[model samples]
Target: MPRPTSRWIAERASVGTSTVRRPDRTTWIVLGRAGADVAVVFLDAEDVELGRRTVGADSWATWAAEIEAGEAVRWVWNDTPRWYAELLAAGTRLARCHDLRLCHAILRDSALVRADADLRVHTDWDATPHADPPAAAPTLFELGAAPDAATGLPEFLDDAVREFARQRTAIDGSTDPGRLRLLTAAESAGALVAVELRAAGLPWDPQAHDRILRGVLGPRPAAGGTPMKLEDAGRRVRAALGDPSANLDSQPKLLRSLHRAGVLVESTSRWELAQYRHPVIEPLLEYKKLSRLLSANGWAWLDEWVHDGRFRPVYVPGGVVTGRWASSGGGALQLPRQLRGAVHADPGWCLVIADVAQLEPRVLAAMSGDRALADAARGKDLYAGIVDTGAVATRAEAKIAMLGAMYGATTGDSGRLVPRLRRTFPRAMALVDDAAREGENGGVVSTWLGRSCPAPSAGWHAAQSLASAVEASGGDETRARRWARDRGRFTRNFVVQGTAAEWALAWMADLRGRLAALDAVPDSDAAPRSGAVFSTRPHLAFFLHDEVVVHAPRERAEAAALAVREAAASAARLLFGDFPIDFPLDLRIAESAQDD
Candidate 1:
């Protein structure tokens, strides 16, 4: 358990009473505790009834909040509950309590905290399930679902491999440039385990070969770890499904067995678990190894496509939690952190790559009644627009500060500048700021489309209730404190970021539908190359957090550009169709991410 800072713990929980002062009846309490701490923040509220009846006052929300809050404070030490007892026994004075807020600026490296923000990556953004269809879903991949490709055999040589595996001294093989293919006997059965260099458009390989595959086949040491207790592991699997005998089958036992052995990442999303393998995991592993070694310097092939104008990247709608799309595969996210040379019309056609500017913030400004912010955002990079409006001194600073503010950042240069932004863009800032404050206090926050981050603990509930009470208490300290820093901040930004995500998803869906309408491929080889040309059928080749790259033919480059822009506008109109704001785009024609 973590030790609460001397200044942060509530008066009742503090270690010493020196310089002690009672907090206002209503006060803002920050929460960053692990597990059940969230529940504690909630249940320990100053005003439980008012907190219980928040908008959408269904019993369901109240019950859910209570259950979640109770769960938050739960701690398991050697399978036994523990935590807070020690502090309670110590009878610590209120003076020992420190600020409840876990600001990275101060608490990050402090010994009292359990972990720092730097090490605390965006882990909460759940590694969701894979949206891509299974190998069986695609029509062309039918042969793969049959016995032929089960062992990673190429379609043309399927018969030969079946015969080879059936009558061989060894059915196993390793894929390396030298001694890449080998047939060997295994302990249990004969199988073919080798890599094959697939085409460019295939989704399995390309990028994330390490991160994704590592989670699959795992690290290949000179020697594998001690084998797990098959029976012992199976027990956990059976218990998890709530049926004692469900895991009797080899498959169920094996899945549970692998999970216990750490071969599979246990998650609720089955789609994300698509990569899990036990006996059936070899094909994916083979693909990963082949991809890594084949294009060892992976970007060489990526660059090859850029140079030849044959790269069309797929986009996954709602790929990221904040409403952004990710490339279906390849190093789309890992694009070398520099711009690629401008694509000059493939010797005849000029590349027309355009991206919208200041997208999320402007969407937010329009949503909130902040005329000042909207006016500044008009027809410009919203960050620069803020700078021009004196939110900050420079665009670079504006970029860093505004991003930090929207996501509840309160450290570094942002900590200094966000206050100024809040004053200028109150209406816009209020939406997100309120969410963060709620988050800090263990209260839940949601997107415009109703996606919500679950509420934290009893302690969190108490904090929000306390803050709300401060508001009701007639300009008292709790209300003043909450609004001063948190409520205003969270509310200002949430509407913008959440709405922006919605717009992005619509754009991706539109592009995907458009691409699906193109002419059919006559051959597999032609299909991969043809995806690069958008004249007959423009396909999106690469999608970044906020930008997209299309590899179109010499004739249809301009049309593809227009298609991308129009889709973005359509997305805006569809989402806010009834609203009267013009969600504009700052389209730029570029060749690559490196391009302007």
Candidate 2:
């Protein structure tokens, strides 16, 4: 009789005797770096060793591509970006992967994991990603040692096997194995999507970008000069203050100028400026706007980032504490609306743009299992539905109330409206309120999928302790209360935002697979600019927190739109099974991503 599977079995490497390819069997191939060579270890569905092969560094791409050509296999590796980016550069595509580094981070901090799990003690797996994109595809023989700090864990076959075993053991011992399993799977899939999005860049139009800049700033300035419109605005602002040569770019000088002109604003922020009636306000605002465009996403930006009609930004998945993606370079997250016209599609193709209407509140409704809130969210406008329930007088009030409830607002209109929401939607209000109280009391709160908020800092604890003393000063108590409220706000928002991020990951992962399964276009119709794997098929081009842009052939635009919707439904179902909450998307199929 076969021995029952256990951690002991998982640690052992049993090389299969079969030399011939087993196309019918599902295999897990673990890739590792051996000194001046590449180590490939294969395991079958039950993880019994299938075989081991060492391919020369020079032939690694060819070997990997051959394996990808097979029926059913999932690659397992230390980091997706490190291994997959090179294979993608070589025109190889993969179906699935188990990213050990990402999964380790998830399991280590996950609230579901048992406290005694060994994964919690593996401090080596806590390394951050390399700030730069992966090193250029190296010659297999030259890829000797893993770069220090590039990965936290060892990049050898044995270490990979042992780490994978530890991760499995943690998952099996977790309080909620099913939820952790799904979260890990979704997190791994997000790793794949991040790499692919970088490989298959968003289509860009340089001319359109140039036009927007020119229209706003009056053409690019010659070397060592500001744009014509920006210079004109600066002159008007200086003239209004009766100092023709006053420097508007310098904040102190500008503030002094405003004060001298009888504008009693404390700062140069737009909102503060709006409160004033000074002649300099409008021109100063315009100058700041144009100056930002010049500095952030101007001609120099176009020259550096955009290449071959595509804007390829490096996406760092799980970078933010709330699990939202962060960009290393290319300013992808802050893409200005003015530049949307630059995000055009290739000829004979379309951009399928979609974003959830109000992801966080909808997520809160589902996660808290507040049937009333869920019913309010059954349609397109969740805020309007809240108004129908008499939570507030108007959609705007409902929005303010909901935002206040999730973000821990204590003042202004949001604060005033929040009480009404609490009275109407007690269950939904209770979740965030509890999270906030826990944070203020030095406790950690977790998202629906078990990603926990970070622990309170020593400084925070010290402040709270000082305030508890018999002789504590008013200032001490005030400072402590302020810090506690700040932490409360952070934890309160963390659960909603983090869970929303998980939903987005599931959506993108499902959409990526659906797009890959679509029919490929003929070579003549391929957009080679998208790189190898996506050149001939519909694929994800860009993803922000709750939005996705799919570049699809015109013939498949309708199908791609349907795929996107279906993927969203699948993600919602996977996250909140039978919760009866709906995630309605504001979807559009257009030649360019320009808003109407």
Q: Which sections of candidate 1 miss by over 4 Å?
A: 1-319, 323-329, 339-351, 457-496, 512-528, 531-535, 578-596
**Candidate 1, position 347, lDDT:** 31
Point out the worst 10-residue segment of candidate 1 by lDDT. 187-196
Candidate 2 residue lDDT tens string, 1-596? 33223222223223333433443455677778766556766666655565665667788887677666644567888778877888888888887898888888888887788878998887767766643445545432224555334322224575677777788889989888888878888888898888888889999999999998899888788877888998898888888889987888889988988888899889999999998887888998988888888888988899899999999998888899988899988989988998999999999889999999999999999988899999998975999999999879999899889998999988999989999988888888999999899988999888888888788889999999999999899999999999999999999999999999999999998999899899999988888999988998999999999999999999989999999999999999999999899999999999999999
Q: State each model's C-alpha RMSD to the native.
A: 29.5, 4.9
Backbone atom clashes (below 3 Å) for every candidate: 75, 2
Q: Global lDDT for candidate 2?
A: 0.84
lDDT of model 2 at position 487: 93
Report every candidate's CA lDDT.
Answer: 0.40, 0.84
TM-score of 1: 0.42
Model 2 error, position 57 (Å): 3.0
lDDT of 1: 0.40
**Residue-wise lDDT of candidate 1 within 220-255, one digit each (tens)?**
223323112333344445554444665333445545
